[model samples]
Target: MHMSPVRDDFRRSQLAIAALFFLLGFQYATWVSRIPALKARLDLGEAQIGLLLMTCGVGAAVSFPLVAVLMRRFGSRLLSVISALALGVVLVALSVVPDYPLTLLVLFCDGVAVGCLNVAMNAQGAALEARYARTTMSRLHATFSAGSLLAALLASGVTAFTGTLAVHFGLAAALLAVLVVVARPGLLTDDAPAAAQDGPDQEQDGPDQEQDGPDQEQAPAAKKDRRRFALPAAATLWMGLAMVFGTVTEGAMNDWSALYLKDVVNAGAGLAPLGIAVVSVMMVLARIFADGWRTRFGDGRIVRTGSLLAGAGLALALLVGGVVPTLIGFACVGLGVAAVTPCVYVAAARQGSDALSLVAAMGTTGLLAGPAVIGFIADATSLVWGMAAVAVSAAVVSLCATRIGWPAPEPHPEPHPEPHPEPLDGRLAPDAG
Candidate 1:
């Protein structure tokens, strides 16, 4: 099979993007496995650790708006490359720093870099997809998930074998260096037209359409009507809610799964982390394979179906007495949540490609907020209620999907033949598996 959409020049750019995303994923949860070490080294209480981690959120939120400027000015390549490299270094710095205040500063920057890179990569990837004939978003995302899985293994192995987190972070940095060498060519220096480069061969493959609307040919208006921290468009709001619900479950698994396995199931300490790891492994696997399923099924259908499965899975985890059932429930939660988030990003980018950075900035802030709120709720109420609250939220996410901001399908105009028949302008067309 061909590596690119049609043996295209931009193939390397797509590959590079895939690699960048993969490394980003690898970095995200590596710290989770190392948190115990961090806690012990810093002599931090749970509350202190929580407060310190919250600074990461603040940094991420603060860095988002700056991405628009970075993308607009220095262009995507240098900005993204710098961010990726910076994060790897900062993570290492965080590991070695002895002072609490210094560690907090390093982590804050780490969070900012993570947040900015997320927006930049999606925007860059979406543009690259426009340059190529087929869809690359889901596959790019799959690559990221692959990296997450790798990080999970590395996390477990390195922690068990050596106490130092710096070595693993150094390896992650090395991967980022390799990624920069591979994926930075053929990408537009500015947010220039996608079709100008990739349009020669790509058949416009939007879902069925009617007569084109004014917005169809022109740029999306997300930045033109930007808001600092306002509610997203109607569709975005619903999609964000879906993410909030899904992430509630994710956070609970990350925090409370081991406890549940130990307390509820009478598992040993050694076995407890195993239960949580199993759930996380399932989640990473689902993101790799199942996330792209939405491109085939409409986002609405996937959201509706996924919610029922997720809710059922969560309920089983709560009510079922057997460990087997709980594991399966967590697996279902993973599978159900995988597609919804990627779908939201795809929708947001497609709808507001011109405002791509702004859309991502807003959406990711919502993304970060989800887990933070969940943790706070868990602390406020009992952890049991927190998990149950997550179950109920899944239903709401599926319900909200029906009302998300997908552009209304257009009617194909019979009288006029269009140059490209894509659903949105360089917004999103499905990628090859």
Candidate 2:
């Protein structure tokens, strides 16, 4: 019945990390809820808007390649705080940017912030989960869904009253920035890879070896570990692909769900955001339950089940097209896609910091591509078909789940005992002393 101090630290860290996730979701959902307003303010066509939205992807592509390097040099904890603050600033700027080009620039910067937060926060989550020796990432992610759900519902009410993005966004930004600053202390300060490195280094250099041994005593093992830390191309690619599929579904919901409801389902302004909110609500509920499911079923099975659920849900929405059925569909999709990214990140983290960063960067492409792809499809065919992309991506995720090969969680390493001193007389030591 007694918990160790390490468990306590991990528990506190989990709450802190979950707060960051919630803040992130709140920020993102606020922006998404206002996209319809921004689209109207700029007087842009669907294709043009989608193209501009792709600027975020451009920023993500630029930033993703740098996550590992930046995380190593600055540490994920610091980077997360810095980036969250920057993202808040960017969100505010997005509200008031006068022209489309400026909006693109601001959005690109927002994308950079998004990419950094993804890497940094996931690093923190993975570290905490590793420390606790259990599945925690999904629950942290569920907090994000809770934030998004709240934001959407709040935006719906606020827009009905005020009809302005700037006021809503500015208030949220100020509050979110303050929360990020307050939460900064609780994040894991050191890189998980660095912690992994420390273990091997201490093992190679015993208490006795520390006094007179040359640094080269551990050179071979250090060199091998360095090699292991190199990005594993195969693992990174598969995990990234899985993330891409999951994120595509997520991105579609974030960027297009409201529009889909408004344009295709013919929902009224008051009801337009309801579908998206329903999605968020279902996602929140699913993620809340995902940790237990992950433990009982493992990542692959859980993700596969979720993906199938999401696909069926989207397919229902596409076929039904009416407001009622669409809401039901989105809710189903939300439940289905909830578990994919959390499980993927947890799996990636087990590989090490390098793999975590690489997989996160790779997965971020879906966030960038999802809106743009949907926009293009909507332009060419119809919003209904564009919505089909969510179903398709969900199906792809289901297919990729088995290939993810969810390995068992890595075992925690035990501390080594100090070596006893040799007697000055040089007699043989007792074997069972």
TM-score of each: 0.75, 0.74
Name the TM-score of candidate 2. 0.74
For candidate 2, write residues 1-433 as lDDT tens digits: 8866656666778888988898888988888788888999988789878776677767866685566567766777888898889879987898889998888888888878887888789878866655444678889988886778788898888888898888888888987888887787788865543433332233443453466574654565445545645636465567778898898898889789999888887889999988778887788788888877776766778888889988988897788678888888888888888889998886666555566776777677777777778899989998888888779889999887766647452243221122111220011111110
Give residue 219's lDDT in candidate 2 (0 to 100): 66
Encode model 1's per-residue lDDT on 1-433: one tens digit a residue: 6544334445666677787788788887677557778899889999878877788777876775676556545656677878887877877787789888898898888888987678767767756544343445656777776877788898888767778767776766666677666666644454433322122122432221123553562333223224322434454455556655655555656667777777777767787787667766665676566534544555567667887788878887788656777777767777776666666565555433324554454455555565556567777975556666667777777887776644222132121222243433533432311
Task: Enumerate clash totals for all models, in the order shown.
Answer: 12, 0
lDDT of each: 0.62, 0.74
- After best superposition, candidate 2 residue 205: deviation in angstroms? 14
Name the runs in model 2 displaced over 4 angstroms: 1-7, 31-52, 92-102, 149-170, 194-232, 253-275, 312-330, 374-389, 409-433
Model 2, C-alpha of 361: deviation from truth (Å): 3.1
Q: What TM-score quantifies how close candidate 1 is to the native fold?
A: 0.75
Q: 127 in model 2: Cα distance from truth in Å?
A: 1.0
